[model samples]
Target: MSDDGQDLAEAQRAHWQSAYGDHPGMYGRQPSAPAVHAAAVFRAAGVRDVLELGAGHGRDTLYFAREGFTVQATDFSATGLKQLRAGARQQGVAGRVTTVVHDVRAPLPLPDASVDAVFAHMLLCMALSTEEIHAAVGEVRRVLRSGGIFVYTVRHTGDAHYGAGIPHGDDIFEHGGFAVHFFGRAMVDALADGWRLDEVQPFEEGDLPRRLWRVTQTLPRERA
Candidate 1:
């Protein structure tokens, strides 16, 4: 990576570290609405092993573990993962969950065709550049098994804070010490190349009513 790229990566990582350090369980205890909906989708698809990106504080990771799915939960924040691990132990599902500190901007450490499902909540809209997002999606496509599912959520252009703060990139804005790359319908469509897009629906959550797009995609048995 270039110096500029490295600098951006460091800044993003430092921001998350500070954010998680300040509030260990920042997103709260309950799983987000997208996660709740995703659980049912996984159940219907008979998913077994799940790889969750940005498993912040393990709220949703715990839900999947409790549902009898073996999960590999990953996040960049060690402090947040510590809280997640404690929660997993308390839920009596420590054996079913594994935690790893991973930065999504880099290539994922997981193996190809190893997981039946990949779940990411509010991860795609981070400070990643367009190239990085494409790289991350390529990683997801590689790690997914035949017909494996990928589900992710991100803040969309329709959000109240879409352009509320300092402009960073296309739709990216810096607010509250964090840089967020908000998505639009066109951006979502561009990311759906290798996989069969199941859905891309808009929804809102949180006390501030954060606008988001819940995307579901499935890998086909054969690739081109």
Candidate 2:
């Protein structure tokens, strides 16, 4: 990792450690709906090896492991990893899951074309800049095997600018003193250059009426 990348990782680790260190159910105990749906898509695509980035608390990691996939999960937070380990033992899938402390701002430790499926939930939005998003997307494309699947979810960029259900301008939104970038269809298409778009849908959270986009893409057999 570069010096800048290392610094960024350390910063991210500190942020998550402070944010979710005390909350056992940080996001939730159960796997996210987007992740569950992505798992089904991977199963349908005949995926066996899975790599998950920003795997907070291992809800999806444990879910995939229990379903008989070799899972490698990475996060920057040691506290989050500890919680994940506990969750893995509780779920009886500790043997199937491997946890690594990693910062996505740096190069991923995995080799090229090493994973059959890659999952990133709320990862891109966590990036504070477009450059970071591009870097994250590049890494996602780099580790996925040809014809592998990439599934992710992000806050609806549109929702933040306009009202929740109304259409508005293209700008970042301020909520709870945090800046979040919602994604648009055009931005999604640009990010998925080498991947075949399988599905893109806007759906609301089960607990809230706010909408977000879920995107699934398959790596191209040949580079575009």
Candidate 3:
């Protein structure tokens, strides 16, 4: 990504920071369903080390750490990280959790093939464009070890309530006083070329239907 793109991402992060910085439990105290599901997958697969992108409030991070996984929880907001650190300390799992400030649209700071599992919840849906989503996916690919698992949830483009007749090519959605992007399966699969698709479960939250993709793949022979 260019410097201009980084600036836009930073701006978006700042917007979110301002919106939820004071409410530490804005995302929730417990992990999202996708994160809980991902934890089960990781435990079943015998994976121990986990990296979570956009780990708002460290809900999943705290859960995974308490379950004996070494977790690196990262977000772009300093306020979010401060809340996450406080949460970890309160849970007495601060040693098990490592927090970092990372913008997913940029290259990840971790060493190549370092993480055993990756989790992203409601992240892909926030990118304003397909190009940005692909860049974030590239960063996800960069930080995972071979045969690592990736479990994430995205707002499906097919939901009527959330879809709101938005054009197929349009990535942005304005609803419920929030503007975010929704992704279709095609767009997600396009960026997930090397990864083997394990599951694409369609479900609903309240009235909003969503899709969760669970995948496990080896790092391609080439580096990002």
- Most accurate candidate by lDDT: 1
Candidate 1, residue 201: how far the Cα is off, in Å: 1.1
Better of 1 and 3 by lDDT: 1
Ranking of candidates on lDDT, top first: 1, 2, 3
Query: For model 2, which pairs clash?
Result: 156-182, 157-182, 157-183
- TM-score of each prediction: 0.95, 0.85, 0.85
Query: Global lDDT of each model?
Result: 0.88, 0.77, 0.74
**Cα lDDT tens digits for candidate 1, 116-222:** 99999989898888788889999999999899999999998888888888786667788887778999888899999877999998888887888999999998887
Model 3 Cα lDDT, one tens digit per residue, 49-84: 999888877888899988889999888887888888
Model 3 alpha-carbon drift over 4 Å, by segment: 1-11, 160-169, 206-224
| lDDT (10s digit) by residue, model 2, range 1-224 | 44644444455556678777767657777788988898889998899989998898888888888888889999887788888899889888888889999877778898998999999887776534556677888988889888999998887755533343322123334443334557777778988887799889888775545568899999878667
Off by over 4 Å in 1: 1-5
C-alpha lDDT of residue 56 in model 1? 78
